[model samples]
Target: MESVSTSSVMDILNLLKACCSQSCNYIMTYGGTFSSLASEVGQLKDKSSDVKRDVEAATRDGQTPRSEVLGWLSSVQDMEGEAESIERKYNQKIKCLCSFPLNVCSAYRLRNRAEAALATIRELKQSAEFTKLADNLNLTRSIKMPTTKTIGMDKVFEELQRHAKDDSLSVIGIHGMGGVGKTALLRRFNNDFPSETEADVVIFLELSIDYKLEEVQKSLFDRLSLTWQDEVTHRDRATKLFRVLSTLKFILLLDNLWEPLNYQVVGIPLPAPPSKCKIIFTTRTEDTCSHMGTEKMIKMECLEEEAAWNLFRNSARMDVIDADKNVRIEARDLVKECGGLPAALIVLAQAMAPKKTWEEWMHALTIMKDTPHQLPGMTNNVFSILKLSYDRLSSDNMRVCASYGALFIKGSWIGKFNIRNSWIGEGIIDNVQNVMDADHKTQFLLGILHAASLTVRVHDDYFTMHPMTRAMILWVQRECGKKENKWLVWDRERVEEAPAAEKWRDAERIALVWNQISDLPEAPQCPNLIFLDLQVNKFLRKIPNGFFLHMPLLRILELQETSIEELPVSIGNLMQLHYLNLCKTRITSLPKEMTALVNLKYLSLAFMKYLRIIPDQLISSLRELQWLIMMDSYSGWKEGQSCEGGVSFEELESLKRLKVIGMTVSTLAALQNLCDSPRLAPLTH
Candidate 1:
């Protein structure tokens, strides 16, 4: 080496040291590395077994293992196999001597590989310390509801669908009267929900008159599969509900909301601007819609004419309706009487389905027109269902007025002025001295009834009552009492004779208008009779002498459009009569006994063209009379002398409290008498 330097010698010695260190370490550490690898792999295997046991238990408990957990278990399995192979190879290597080059090399490489495997096993074992091994898989999102046949709901469905597509309309309301297909519409809507991207969950609840917050919460928890801890407070449950509902796209269909529901107290988060949640409810009153903060309201109306006929024809047997030409005519008339209401149409149709003859159909029509409550399904099925609306009225006066409205025949337009006067006269609207204020209050109450869907407004001056609502009122009056015959309404029917005497014994109100009765009951003992209407009996020529004997409580008596020519001496026995209508009758004289009517407030003698005589002081005897209508009749008036056996103008002017007076003045003297008296001029019509 041509005199090598000291630096070169140092470099050679360092290289030799590194090479020996590497080789010796690999060869010596094989046993320790192998032992460590086996230990770690065994630990990992134990952890894998533990994880597999946990996963199996979770599966039995209706849960699914996490993907990462399953992956870790697979890695551990691979690690175990590799460790076993490495152990076998190490054992073989150890059997040979460390002096052999091939055995030393093989042991060194195997030791390195074993150490790497051990590191991997350690990593897998650390990762195997999982906090949660599985996820719960029992949660259900939506349940389907039963379907029903629907007709004439296509337009309503289109409107609902249109509103649903609008993100701005989070809360929708369906408002209508009771028995007007509100519940049916809601069911249909619930059945047609949850498209692929529409909602993740759907819930339908019936919050009728009786619903509580806890009950509602319990239902929601059951649907959501939440742990409903009985001991937990409502606040805690609410919090849990909010937390869970916040992550879902949901729809809640609420049916039959009598009043506004408090969502905050129920823990239902308001759906809105960001979250995809919707709420829809059905109500009988529009005020509920307003109170519930509905963004869109769909009003339910009675079916149209064609639709009503179709529904009726289907509900009734088509064969029955089309049996004969006469049957078809009567069926059409019956359908007209239903006033296009689907509930009434269906019920009435079904009731008439079994009738085989036109005569039976005509009889059914008569009953429906006169006493609808007497129809087979009218009282129990139709009116009772509609009674809920009447019962939910806010005040007794509202309920009374609603029932009073039923006195008007179905489909007849009632003048607003007429109703107001009738209400005032019947003491329904009392204690208001100012006429304007009373009229305003009456309008306000009428508006409330209109909003409640009990009455349908026809125009600014008139409104009409639905036939089914009227029937419900009548049913309440007649059947919902111990005395089921309290109200006897037989108006505008083919009554050839009067009802039995027992039928009138406990009656409070009796109407027998537009009948063909030739004779009256000789003596019907109606002790509780308050209103007796015998109007429009064309053949009613005379009232028996004792007809009004036992009716001591009689207040309103109507004998208009009859053929009676004389007032019985017993007419004066009705001391409590507040209203008396004798218009269009053939009466010619007033009985002298009429002087006993002291409480008479309303007297109508309009169109009594044959009226020619008035007992002296007959008009003046009515000290409390406020309204006197004699239009187109009873114009035989004298100034001071009762010479012509007619009413005296001074006697008419004697009514100091009279507010409305409608009369005809056939003579210039009578016109001058009316115009000269300033007191009666303003009140005259």
Candidate 2:
């Protein structure tokens, strides 16, 4: 039997190495091209194994035409040898030409050789035998698993493993205080479980406090690669999700549970009694785990003193071998102040990492000692540590932005765009000449907060403040004196009536949303107020006529989902108001006096089913109006009625700055006359 040529084997190996090196160099020099040629090369590389296997089988069988097979093999080897020679020559020419004048002859020769080599490769790929070998190969891509190493908590992990091994234990709970490393331990467990047990699937989800049912369903659908129809109702989605999950034997791991989650509501089916599937969850309170029906509870404790110091030293990059005795002593004391909490220790260490001197370390220690441990509204020490990080923010703008984020409900999600608008409305952003500038500044501030770990990203355009960070922000507000800043009362807070006049005297921004307030007390003394949110107060029946008289500086007023029947004639007094939200209200018509708000930029009257009219010149009079939301409203217009309550769309052409208009077909007819107007050409859907 004839053996394969040794030179051919060597040529093939060299060609493979050269191709890999060239591919890397091309990617680095030109980035990814994603062209068809590149894709074909990738497929050829994947088929190399099949090509070798087929050649081996042919040689062993010795049944086919040896001359034809050997001829094809020799051609491939010759092409690879020529390609390698061309690449080497080109690279050598490039190196020699880098420091001297270009050699035109050498450059032209190298380019010709490269083109000839490429042509040969194309010819080889087009061969019928090569194509058949490529078709016979089954290529698979492998993803590397993430590596996880927890610093402490071996005992807890052992207990968790024990519970997981027990076939009777379907649900296991891990609960601990904030910053105690509950998340880290859970992550370790997740990473190690697949190696220890056989499970069909493992799904990990971080359930923020404000996670909506739809959001959870969407996440599951995406992870499972299931198709969902557009505009499907929540119940339909839930049913579809249930049908999929009920058939799989899977392990579900949920983290950061703020409240007990109902599996059925979230479309997760209960595991059958004899199944090996398990469910695990982590939360701050054991009671929540109990409420979720966990069969076994694993409580996570803070690190020991020795382990705490070790972790802190590692994170801070502090070298004990070279440090002075005094610096070491102070560092140990600071670690103790962290209260054995891994998160606090790491953050504090990182914050102090750049300060190498003992004096800087002592100063940080003194500040921590002097700072109050107790926040007015919270009973946890987590805020004390979080405030330390907050105080270290780079600028006052960053601090203000972070503190302002806390004005939202404890677990509420805040949209980045909405918050930026609110900041502009309240005049918090300085030197912001236009909306674009304000948005840039807002994004910068949010980036700073995220880097400092003061806020957690919830989605692409939204974020949620950590509960401890929220508490610290409230403490900052109280420290600044709430009377001079923001005061928020929202979500489940029941207030029968608005604050007294004196209570609003020094307030700059007040939010009383999602409450049961029935009436607004006379607030004629709120001269410094800038933002007032009274949204979702269904029982709010009336506002005093004098309420707007003193708030001349007000910029944003939200009264959506209210029962108010009419606006006071004095509403025109808010000349500084830029945003007005009266959506879903029962108001029949806007007061003509509101036409005097020249600075109004955003006006929302959407879903006002009872709204029959908008005062004739009310919208056209606001020269700066940019966003006008009037969809699903004003459908009761009569041909014979007075035009006083009807808006003339032609008149809207005068408001040249309008950028967005949400209206129905009946209302869009108003823009017929303005269709040719260049000023209205930039309107967005």
Candidate 3:
């Protein structure tokens, strides 16, 4: 609002007084002032009775003259300046009040106000002296609200810019639902716009859901810096408007509408082809867009993934550049967890960044899991989110990791994106102690985590973790008890359901707690699966060969309760398998079929409750297996017993890559010329 400057008001008042002075010369050349002319005004009133007959006859015939309007306006002095202020105040209010919800009665009220503004404009125009001094620069109304930068709207703006360049259209309307960024989009468009030179006037009118002609006129007059008579003949207002706009072109904004369009309702002249004018509007209804005959009827849709992620990163203040290496890794995991819903991504990213510790991250994820999913689109609550993540894991490792779920927790605010886990820090290896390159196990772990969909991306280095992952982790922990809680009975199912073809996966890193269950489910069929954590299912006996046949992405398999086991000759066929755990189980002998496990990285056979025979050929085929674990004394040292491993160092050339060894029988020095393999690796080792 202009705030109605005191000087401007005073000047308008003085001009009104001066007009009265000159008017005194025409009718009664001798007069004191407007106050003194009260008597003369009475005389005019007396004359009005005589003309009343003629005026009444014309009024009955629907004819009103400019002279009649001027005569009425001439009598008013105190209210002239006040009228301008009043019109402006309401224009600002109506413009800001929103135009879409106007029912028929509201339309009338707005129409009346616009008519009143037109009357005020007409009255002000009758003042010849004021008109001579003031060209009347109209001000546009309906200020824009603050906006944020997101990616997807760039395409919308570019489309509009192309239209602006074409300059062939007379009108453009951007239509969409509330809070979907229509207004924000328009405001951004208007602010960065470069087409102002084409129109003499750019005016914004609150179209009152339906275009009542008068409201349009008022908005136009307000923009033109024109005023009208408070009480006037309609012809006078119309004439004044024509006189003002005859030389100018205008771009009118008929915004926030919900009803059908009719331009004439605004009392503006309809221009012929190449009208060189425009009327743009915004509305939630498509019908509104079509009825207006907008040249470019643009509908606003939701931001896509990249846009959502950018919005989240920007909102969370998580620019990857400033983060340290460790923190950057954590941030990457964080963004991946919060899928690209604009609101949820931002809310979650902001909440997680302040607390950089893994502990806090875990807490946040747990919270989001149990909380209702109210993220973008409100399409689906996070029902199968955990299952989605579970589905992404490699087939052979599914039950292993699923059974290790942690205890579930519900809380006030939950965001799947808030959790971050360092694959190393999460103790994933204790379940798969057989696989580790001495130099970079931690970094490798993090990579494996991302590949497994346990973590997802937000930015280059920022990631997010789903809460269900933590819930899975917690469920497994509760089942198996803590690593420190050795005496607890682990029984609850870690994973309840797998994902259907159409669903989102929870991408949170997890570890195995195989000490928790006694059985494994049927193998899965997902080809894109990755990690498998089945470290300690004490009653687990058979592992299906088909487990790894289809899941080419299989990475880690943790099966610790090997005591209740026998390896199918097919166990060696998991070519893509990286980490394998057979910790503390009973196997009478290693199968020669194990020679086919060329990609095997970690093989854990430590803490076996009973002795087991080994197949020497198994060692030769495990060219990539890095870490090895086995119990020693249980080798069953019977006289004349056939030993499965007696290979010389010369034949163990493939053992050069070996690093950490958890073994009971196989001697690495005798095999690889290194010192004997450890009976058990150091706790830190």
Q: Which candidate wins on TM-score?
A: 1
Worst 10 residues of 1 by lDDT: 93-102
How high is each candidate's TM-score? Answer: 0.70, 0.44, 0.33
Estimate the overall C-alpha local distance difference test score of candidate 3. 0.48
Q: lDDT per prediction? A: 0.79, 0.67, 0.48
Candidate 2, residues 251-314: lDDT per residue as tens digits?
7888877668888887888775566788889876555777888888887766888988877777
Sorted on TM-score, best first, the list reads 1, 2, 3
Angstrom error at residue 633, model 2:
2.1
Give the clashing pairs for model 1: none
Look at candidate 3 and tell me the lDDT of residue 431. 37
Error of 2 at 143 (Å): 39
Model 1 lDDT per residue over 1-685, tens place: 6356677888899999999888777675557677778777767777788889988856643456888998888888788888889888766653546433356667678777888898898898778778778764455556766643456778898888778767878899999887778777777777776465457677888764877788888888777766677898989888777756665677888888988988877778889754468888999888989998898899999888888888888775668666599999998888888887878888887788788898998998888776777777777777877898888899887887787677766667888876776666566655453456567878888888887889989998889899878877877887563455787776666687988888899898887868887788888999999887788888999999988888999987888888999888888889998888888999988898988999887888899999888888999989888778889988778854536657777887787767778899988877988899888887787
Which runs in model 1 stand beyond 4 Å of their true positions? 1-4, 9-141, 194-197, 231-243, 272-276, 312-337, 344-380, 480-485, 494-502, 514-519, 536-545, 559-569, 582-598, 601-685
